[model samples]
Target: MSFEHEKQVCNLFHNSMEIIGRRWTGAILVSLMDGPKRFNEFHNMIPEISSRLLTERLKEIEDYGLVTRTVLSDRPIQVIYALTEKGAELQPILQLIGNWAARWDSKPNIEENTTEKVLNI
Candidate 1:
């Protein structure tokens, strides 16, 4: 490939990782991959996430054009979160990551509630 094209590709990959690497963003995208989910449903799905962080992640994804939030005209103004077309396209990538995780999952060396650290072998 040409130098300019290579640089462009690298930049796009860098930007994509920077955006997706944020806390809960990747999880939220993966959760919404199947279809729309309500706010409470997301909370239940990802029990570890705090409300503030959840709200922040949702807004961030929405701002990134990957998520579409629909407000239902119901008694309580229900909100549903769904992936946009671009977001849906990320399914393959997520699956690949999941596949890689499965490879290491069987030999997980980290204990629960422990901060991650690399073992220099």
Candidate 2:
């Protein structure tokens, strides 16, 4: 492949990593797995998230092609979000990550810090 094409691929890979690495991306994916839901439904489900941030993350997820957005024609129009097939593919990946995290759960951060200090000296 040409150098320019390789550089473009690397940039795309890094951009994707940055998107999923955000604080709430995982939770947002989990939240959408049940079914398509309206904005208010998501807001209530993920109470810890601020409205602005949730909207931002949802837009990012949409841009990534993992979710679909639909608008309903009704007396009061509604906007709903649903995970596309690609988004659903992350469930097993998330489960594996959860299992990996279980091993480190409740471990002391100070212990790791001290170990790092000792290793450096």
- In model 2, how large is the Cα lDDT of residue 11? 99
Clashing residue pairs found in predicted model 2: none
lDDT of 2 by residue, 1-121 (tens): 9999999999998987787778788778777767888999877767889989988999999999889999999869999899999888876766566555544668665354432232221
TM-score of each: 0.82, 0.73
User: What TM-score would you give candidate 1 relative to the actual structure?
Assistant: 0.82
So what's the TM-score on candidate 2?
A: 0.73
What is the C-alpha local distance difference test score of each model?
A: 0.79, 0.77
What candidate 2 gets wrong by more than 4 Å, as runs, is 1-13, 107-121
Work out how many backbone clashes candidate 1 has: 0
Clashes of 2: 0
| lDDT, residue 83, model 1 | 93
lDDT by residue (tens digit), candidate 1, 1-121: 9999999999999999887888878778877876799999887768899999999989988998899999999998999999999888887877676655655666667454221211111
> How far does residue 87 in candidate 2 sit from its true spot (Å)?
0.9
